[model samples]
Target chain A: MSNQSLVDAEWALSHLDDAKVVFIEVDEDTEAYAGNHIKNAIALNWKTDLQDPIRRDFVNKEQFEALLSAKGVSNDDTVVLYGGNNNWFAAYAFWYFKLYGHSDVRLLDGGRKKWELDGRELVSDVPSRAATKYVAKDQDLSIRSFREDVLKAIGTQNLVDVRSPDEYAGRLLAPAHLPQEAARIGGHIPTAANIPWSKAANEDGSFKSIDELKALYEGAGVDLNKDTIAYCRIGERSAHSWFVLHELLGVKNVSNYDGSWTEYGSLVGVPVAVGDEPGTA
Target chain B: MSGCGAVVGGVSLDNVDITNQAVIQGVISSGNAPASVGYARLLDRNDEFVAEVPISKQGEFRFFTVAGDWTIVALIPGANSRTPVQATIGKILDVDIAVIK
Candidate 1:
């Protein structure tokens, strides 16, 4: 039940004054941090800070380095990320941190939802820190997957589509709240397991125990022993699952396909399986 | 990056175009004033988690759903509430949730 990749509210509260720990909030709603946040925590807009303005990919390593440097994060600082919507974008940022080879990154368990539900203190005051010269390593391709990788892993690896059942079943192209026209078609990648990412989380927005997570994935026929790639509409949700498998469960070979269904379901002549079942490869 | 960007919800109904869409939208309030902070979660008919969006400073939340029975759960600090809603296409359903501390 111990995970080095996560810290609870108690741990976060105790570390509020820790010079070596940096609390970063990455919310799906970028404005959440402005209204109120955990004291001394800074905000990283998942939309602007993490994404490339022109391309569909993330910001380059230099951008990432400059971002951390501006945020006063040193190479040795332990970065703890948390956000709203069960830390969906926080996990995305965590995966991005890992992709850039940052060694001491962790997620704040339950994120803003759990913190607010617990009646924890949140403040609107922002903190300022001296800028540091931050360095980022090259992208770690091992923890990331491309469209070709997903196509090749159809029958060989465990492809877990972490969208809701309706999305997986081709009934909805995107989440209910989002515009439904992101992809040209609905349905899931062929042979992908339809294990919704929400299953790994609790009602209070905290992640489930390791045993429960393992059981949930295994019950969905996801083979943990095999190389795994998790995807959602745009990869944020799958990053939550990626955090669970690779960080919490200690799975060695897991990747988050950032392009996800937005790329896969829209590609010309790519295999897409419709209906409730996981279609054949 | 069509669906890749963040969807900032909690917008006033005036900003949303509900044309040809089945919408479940609302505002969160406590003591007759807009709740400043909270999240509105959408649950399917079976009570399974569907999606979640942060409430705006104005305490607004909107969901573009298909015609069906759904439950909206408001998670506000020190207070929480849920309301069942039935949505039909080409119509907008407004359900205000009142939470108390």
Candidate 2:
């Protein structure tokens, strides 16, 4: 289903007339991104620029649009999003753009690690200057998942978790960078599936092809045709799943949970599924 | 919500989530030579501890969820783990630390 699943580092290097998109590495420290990055990739502070605690959600529409314009993202630019792991933040950026009406976007299959590991070049501290107008078409809820849908889909649809074993088990915890309780009250979704995001990539950080990817999903006992919903910490990692299912597997009925665990795990009341150390139901 | 420990790379995590987990990955370099390494967790941002982790055979170090947003300063101890060697911290944000050797 991929027009081209693996967008090589060289493509990114050679295709750019000017570094238009910014690579936002989300963490507590800026030193690393400051040291070296994807040339024009700006270090986006997720907390400061991405989310606003006061609103308890992604920034408001005007603010969000302004933020995009401030970042120099325009309506027609084809953006490439990526980050450290599954390019989670990059996926978030992708989701943000799509949510606000932009669609010409894609994620760097392996992200910074893959790029760096492959001996691709790196850029440090120099600010990239390329400005364009990013416009919003509509908040396509179709591309995103909501708690209500997740709650309704609990038994009806399948929830595919791209996190690790610890996360699936109540014993392991995901880091919630919010002002609320960050731990899960229960374990995974009822009778849900677990397929760590890293599995999509090989040891070297390149994505597997349609055959290899299909083999991976089938090996996990996951049925792509069923009603499926993907979720991760804040929906960042899951967006990768959305891309994989839709773009790779051609799986329809796929949605990504926007609130993800941050809201679900912190809720004072919800239908939670706990585990007995994660092995039993 | 996320249940993964911490992403060793990327920024702006000044607090820990009580309900979820995340992952953090990075390399500890010596001068210009990147090496696998580990350090003690400073639960409190201001305190230091005597904990050392042998870098994985792959030359990487990680922390499960001692606390989010807790700064990872080079802890070479007598060698200055906070030494300033010009290594990228991760993707979160950027900083330059000059550890006193």
Stretches off by above 4 angstroms in model 1 are: B2-17, B30-34, B99-101
**Which residue pairs show collisions in model 1?**
B10-B60
The residue-by-residue lDDT of candidate 2 on A186-251, one tens digit each, is 367666677766567654345778798888788977777777888866676687777777667777
DockQ of each: 0.48, 0.08
Q: Rate the local accuracy (lDDT) of all candidates.
A: 0.86, 0.56
Top lDDT model = 1
lDDT of 1 by residue, A1-281 (tens): 46899999889999998989999999756567887899999999887888899889999999999999999999999999998878898999999999999989999999988998787999999999789999999999999999999999998899999998888888777787764453278899999998888999987789999899889987887778899999998999999999999998899799999999888988998888999888888
True-vs-predicted CA distance for residue A28, candidate 1, Å: 4.2
lDDT of 1: 0.86
- Model 2's CAPRI class is incorrect
